[model samples]
Target: MITKKQIDNNTLSDEEIVKRIVNGESYLYEHLMRKFNLRLFRISMSIINDEMEADDVMQTAYINAYMQLSNFQHKSSFSTWLTRILINESLLHKKRKLKQTQLLAAQTDNEYSNDNPLRRLMNKELKVILEKAVSTLPEKYRLVFVMREIEEMSVNETMEILNLGESNVKVRLNRAKEMLRSELSIYYKTNEVFEFNLIRCDRVVNFVMNKINKES
Candidate 1:
């Protein structure tokens, strides 16, 4: 039973934690999953454009990464490697979803309801608007924007994760900002976008923990 105090000591890096898990202290993997759940969720959501599907994509990615943990050579940072797996999973899911939608449309021609942000306005109206604006961005730009601007990852780190050169990363980021600037002038001060609420965070953590425990 890994306690919060053990994880809170914060002395061990991600690499060291992986080593511990590989050495059979499997419970510690929950700490790593919790650490990156929100970032991965945001990443999945940015690509998939559907929250529930994004959640499922993240869960599958985590399970796949854990199963392949031994193959995680020190070629890149653990987060980068995990992110790559997540991106692959999300893209694959997206491809499958597109195919399904095409086939379903051919059969039934059912229409889907547009998610109108105006109807969801509340106290945090600006935040909701900002999230919608970010989500509406073209996929190429949205992922870069979220990784660089929202997650605050460094240029080098973003480049490593996305397999893009610094210039490409900067260019995409600039374009994303330009698009958002036009839409968010009055509401650009707040940085929160696609916030992973605490309840969802705990849910993801518990789901992953339970799955890992059962497998072990």
Candidate 2:
């Protein structure tokens, strides 16, 4: 019974959207997905470091959030709730990937190589260099760096999403910035990192909606 007007209303906050979805207007969940899709994808990519795997993790996280919509308690913003879910899924995926790589005896390379077409392209742009620099950070620092710097999330939001104290969030963010400073002296735009393809966004929306429809 959701209407186009309801979905299109700019004044509708995320909490209101969640309420509508949980109240059985499930078709409106697409609005929530579209709202957080890019941010969640960046979070996934920050952990997984592979485009395809990140996309899978993003989709899985969205599915998990959708299935658990009824249990949402409104303790935090919907974005924070969704982000924690994404972090958990990404960590699990990373663990499984590590085990698989170990089983297959895959060689790990420490040096960045020009063999990767993407890496080659990154070499050509200052903006990509900034992204590559951020990606090179250790996992712990990188997460804080992306949430704080790249995504421009507030410290309070990042701390809540990561379950860290204020001091811990500040320390990690500072360390991440210091690490990047040694490599690049100038600021560059951040929107280019892990750029979400529009076609892929539509695909995820359609896939999730279709799955939800079938289940209902």
Candidate 3:
């Protein structure tokens, strides 16, 4: 049995490790799990809002990924492929749970406590105001916003993942940004400068490349 300790010290690129697993070296897969578990958990959390369900979704995602590894084409990065699997697993879990709830999966606050600094302000009312501002967004706009802003998926990647046209993606993104700006303008009540940053594809690619190097 592969232990968490061993997973932490694993040494193999995703391609090499996946090949090993496909060749019946299943133990090597523990490294892949370790490498991606946190991210999968976060994505699951975003979709489901429950930690336990997110945990289950993460487990199921890895199982599915392993089963489908043979079909993984190297056209896109392995992380992107794995992320698609994770998102699918998460949405499936969400859909199943929504059968018992009145809420939509995309509208829930599935993020951790530290996700936004505005939430940690001393004024509870201000926090609620911020939540209400975000919560009032239409599901479509919110989904695109969270995927783009929080997950940092590229426009092209998000369009591919959601099977949306470029124009539709742009429209949704523009509407989301406009809504946020409108809300923040009201919240700030002045021309206060806000420092917001976005994660670009190059940074993400470089980070994943470094991880691959360290693993191998």
- Of the candidates shown, which would achieve the greatest lDDT relative to the real structure? 1
Query: Quick one: how many clashes does candidate 2 have?
Result: 0
Name the runs in model 3 displaced over 4 angstroms.
1-11, 102-216
lDDT, candidate 3, equals: 0.80
lDDT of 1 by residue, 1-216 (tens): 568766752788898888878888788888889899999999999999899999999999999999988888978999999999999999999999999989998665322313534334453576788898898789999999999888999999999989999999999999999999887765544565666779779989999999999999
Better of 2 and 3 by TM-score: 2
Sort order, lDDT high to low? 1, 2, 3
Worst 10 residues of 1 by lDDT: 109-118
How should the candidates be ordered by TM-score, best one leading? 1, 2, 3
Give the top-scoring candidate (TM-score).
1
| lDDT (0 to 1) per candidate | 0.87, 0.86, 0.80
Q: lDDT (0-100) at residue 102 of candidate 2?
A: 86
